[model samples]
Target: MKKYLLLTNEELKRTAKPYLIVVAVLMLLEFILTAAITKMHEGKIETFMRENGVSMQEAIDAYGKSSFAQVVASGPFLLILGAGMMVILISAFVIWYRDWFGKTNYIYRLLLLPGSRSSIYFAKLTTIVLLMFGFVAIQWLMFFVLAPLHDLLLPPELFERVSIAAVLERSGLMYLYDFYLPNFALIYLFALLLIVFIFTLVLIERSYRKGKKVIRIFLQFVILGAVYGATLLVINSDHLFANEKGMLFLAFTFLYLAFLVIIGLRTVSKKITV
Candidate 1:
C-alpha cells in the first residue's frame, strides 16, 4: 500500500503542471467573457428601462435589479457549467492516458519490479481519479474569485429586493465551503466509476491482442448498443417486469466489468505480447 501511494504521488508530480495550466487559462477566458457580457447587458438594461417612461431613479433600480439576475444566473452560471464540463472531459482524457500511456512507457521498468500487477493498475487508476478531483477544485476556486464581481454593479435596493445574501446562499456560492469537499468527493467517485468502466474496456482489448484493436473497440460498441437497447426496451414497454429489468441490467454490467478485470489479470499474468 505504501509503495502504491508513493508510485501514485510520483505520477501526479510529473503530470500536474500541464493539466493545471490548461484548465486555468480556459477558466480565465470564461471569466473575461462573462464580465464582458455582463457589462454589455447592463448597458442595454439601463437604456430599455429609460425608454419605457420609468423615472430616473426607478429606471436605475430596475436596470440594476434585472441586470443582477443576468450577471449571476446567466453569465457566471453558464460559464461555470462550461468550465465544469471541460474539466471533466479533460479529466477523462487524463485518466485514459495515465493508464494507457503511463503504463506502456515504464512497462518494463515497473513490470519487473517485485510488486502486484493489480496493485500497479489500481494505483495508476487512483492517481488519475485524484488528479481529476484537483481539476474540479481549481475550477471552483477560479469561479469563486469572480462571484463578487457579479454583484459589484447592483444597487442596494435591488440587492435587497432580490435578497443577494439568500440568493447566493441558495445558489450554493455562500455555502461553497460546506459543499466543496463533499461535491468534490461525489464527483470524484462518479468519475472514478466511469473511468474504471472505460479502463475495463481498454484492458479487455489488451486481453485479446491476437485480434485487431479495432475488433476490441467494435466489441465494446456492440456491448454499449446492446445495453442501450435493453434499457430502452425495458423503459418503453410497460409489460417488462420493472424489478427484473433494473436488476438484470445492473447484474449484467457488474458481471461484464468483473469478466474484463479477470481477463486483464490473466493476460497480464500470462505475459502475452501485443
Candidate 2:
C-alpha cells in the first residue's frame, strides 16, 4: 500500500501543476465565453426568435432552447478539441517520459530496488488511466457548467422557461442517457483501451534494438481497428436487439477493458528493458 501511494505520488507529480493550471484556465475561459456570448447576442437572439414563428413572450419562454442552441453547440466543440489535445499531449508525455527516465539512469536504479517490476508498471499504468479519466470528467463538467449560464443570462421569465431543470426533464436527460451517454462511455473506454495498448506497444517496441517502433505502432493500430470493426459488425448484426443495444454496448466495453488490462499485464510482465 505504501509503495502504491509512493507510485501515485510519483505519477501525480508528473504533470499535476501544469495540468491543473490548464484545466482551470480552460474552464474559466469556457464559462466566460458562454456567458459573454449569451449577453452579447441577447438582442440578436430575441430578433431571431421574433423572426421565427415566435413572439417576444414566446422567445422569453424558450430562451436556451430557441436562442442558444447553435452557439452552445459550436462553442463547446472548441472545448472538446482542447480536451482531446490534452489527452494526446499527456499520453505522448507518458511514453516519452519512460524513455527519458531510462536514459537518465533511473530505469536501472529503480529496477534494482526491492520491488516487483509488475508493481512499477501497473502503478504507472493505473496512474495514467486515472489521469486520463480525470481529464474526461473535468471536460464534461466544464461543458455542463457552461451550458446553463446561457439560460441564466436571459430574463427571469426566459430563464424560467428554459430552466436547466426543465431541460433535463423535457428531453435532454432522456436523450443523453438513451443516446449520448452510452456512446460517450464507449468512446471513453476506447480511448483508455487505446492508451493501454499504446503503452504495451511502446514497451514491446522498446524491447527491440532497431527501428521496429514505427512499424509496430502502425501495425498495432491497423490490427486494433480491424478488431474494432469486427466487433462492431457483430454488435450491429443479430447480436443486439433495439431494446438491448445500450446494454450490449456497455457490456462489451467492460469486457473489452478487462481484455486490454489482461493483455497489458501479460505483455508488461514479460522480459523487457526500460
Candidate 3:
C-alpha cells in the first residue's frame, strides 16, 4: 500500500509542472476574457445610449443585458474550454507513451520497480484521475470567482447578475458536472469507465507484439468492442423485463471495470517486456 502511494505520487510529480501551467494559463485567459467581454459590451451599451439619447435601462432593453452565462456561451470561451480538454486528451496518451519514447526508456525502470507491477498501473490511473478532477474542481470554483468579476465591472442595473448556482444552472456544463450529489457520482463514474477503457487499450497494445499486425489490431478492436457491447446490452435490456435497469447497468459497470483492471495488471506484470 505504501508502495502504491509512492508510485502514485511519483507519477503525479512527473506531470505536475505541465498540469499547473495548463491550469494557470486557462484561468488567467478566462479572467482576462471575462474582463474584455464586459468592457466590450459595456461600451456597446454606452454607445447605443449616447447615439439614441436613451437611458441605461432603455439601452439594455434595446440591446439585451449581458450575463455570465452568456459570456461562457460565446465561441471564444468555449474554445478556451476546448483547449483544456485538448490537454487532457493528449495527457491520456502522453502519460504512458512518454515513458517509452522519451530520451531514455523510462518504462524499463518503471516496470522493474520493487513492488507488484499493478502498483504502476494503478499509479498512472490515479494520477490521471487526480489531475482531471483537480482541473474540474478548480474550474467549478472559477464560476464563483468570475461571477464577482462580472458584477464588479458593471453595475447591478447594467449587469444581468445571477447567483453562482443560477449561472451554473443556465450553463451547459451543468449537465456533465451536476451540482446534485447523485448525478455527480453517476457522471464521474462514467468518466472513470472511459479513462479505464482507454488505459486498457493502451496496455493491450503495449503488451502484445508477436501476432500479425492486422490481426492484432483487429483483435484489439474486438476485445474493446466486447467491453462496450456488454455494457450496452445490459443498459438496453429493460425491454426484457429486467427488475431495475439502472441498478443492472451500474452493477455491470463495476464488473466490467474489474475485468479490465485484471487484464491490465496481467499485461503489465507478465506480458510487457522491459
Candidate 4:
C-alpha cells in the first residue's frame, strides 16, 4: 500500500509540475493585463465625466450600454482563463502519451513495478484528477487575489466586485461549476469513466504491434460510438419516462464507470505492452 501510494505521489508531482508552472505564469499575466485594461477604462470614464461635467452615476449610466462596458464586466481575465483551460485539456493526452513515447519509455518500468499492473492505471488517473483540481484551486484563489487588486486599483463605482461564484454564474460556464462542485460524486464518476475509456483506447493501440492498425482504430471508434449512443439513450429515457433526470443520470453514470474501470483493469492486466 505504501509503495503504491509513493508511486502515485511521485507520478502526480512529475506530471503536475510543468502544468503548475504554465498555469501560474498564464494566470499572472492575465491578472496584470486585466488590471491594466480596467485602469485604462476607468481613467477614460473619469476623464469623460470631468470634461462633460457629469456626475459619477450619470457617467456610469451613459457608458453602461456601450460595448466597453461589456468588456469591463467580463474582463480580460476570462479570455486568458479560457486559453489556460485549453492547454490543460490538451495536457490530458500529453500526460498519457509521454509515459509510453517519452525517451525513457517510463511505461516499461511502470509495468514492472511491484503488485498489480492496474496500480499504474490508477496512478495515472489519480495524477490527472489531482492536476485538474489543482487548476480549479488556482482559479478559486485568483478571485481572491484579483478581486482586491481591482478594488484597490479602481473605484468601487467604476468596478463592481465580482466573486468567483458570481463570475461563473454570469458566464455560460455556470453549469460546469454547478455540475462538478455541488454534485461532485456524479461528476467524479463521469470523469473516471472518461479516463478509463481513454486509457482503454491507449491500451488497445499499444496491444497491436504493426499490422491491423486501421482495424484497431476503427474498432475503438465503433466501441466509443456505441457507448455514446447508450449513454444518450439513458439520458433520454429520463425525459421520456418523466422521472428525476439527476438521479437516473447518476445511477447510469455509476454503472458505466464501474464497467469502464473493469475493462480498463482487464486491458492493462492482460493486453497492455511497452
Query: Which candidate number maximizes TM-score?
Result: 3
Better of 1 and 4 by TM-score: 4
Residues 9-53, candidate 3, lDDT per residue (tens digit)? Answer: 988998999899999999999999999998899999999999999
Candidate 3 or 1, higher lDDT: 3
Local accuracy of candidate 1 as per-residue lDDT tens digits, 20-55? 786677777767755776567666666776679666
Candidate 4 on 176-249: residue-level lDDT in tens? 46655537666656655666667766766777666665687677678667876887787776355544666766
- lDDT of all the models against the reference? 0.59, 0.61, 0.81, 0.69
The runs of at least 3 residues in candidate 4 whose Cα sits more than 4 Å from the true structure, single-residue gaps closed, are 43-56, 65-76, 179-182, 209-213, 234-243
- Per-model TM values vs. the true structure: 0.66, 0.68, 0.87, 0.81
- Against the true structure, what is every candidate's RMSD? 5.6, 5.2, 2.7, 3.6
Ten residues in sequence with the least summed lDDT for candidate 2 = 170-179
Ranking by TM-score: 3, 4, 2, 1
TM-score of 3: 0.87
lDDT for model 4, please. Answer: 0.69
- In candidate 2, how many Å is residue 254 off? 5.4
Better of 3 and 4 by lDDT: 3
Q: Which 10-residue window in model 4 sums to the lowest lDDT?
A: 64-73
RMSD of 2: 5.2
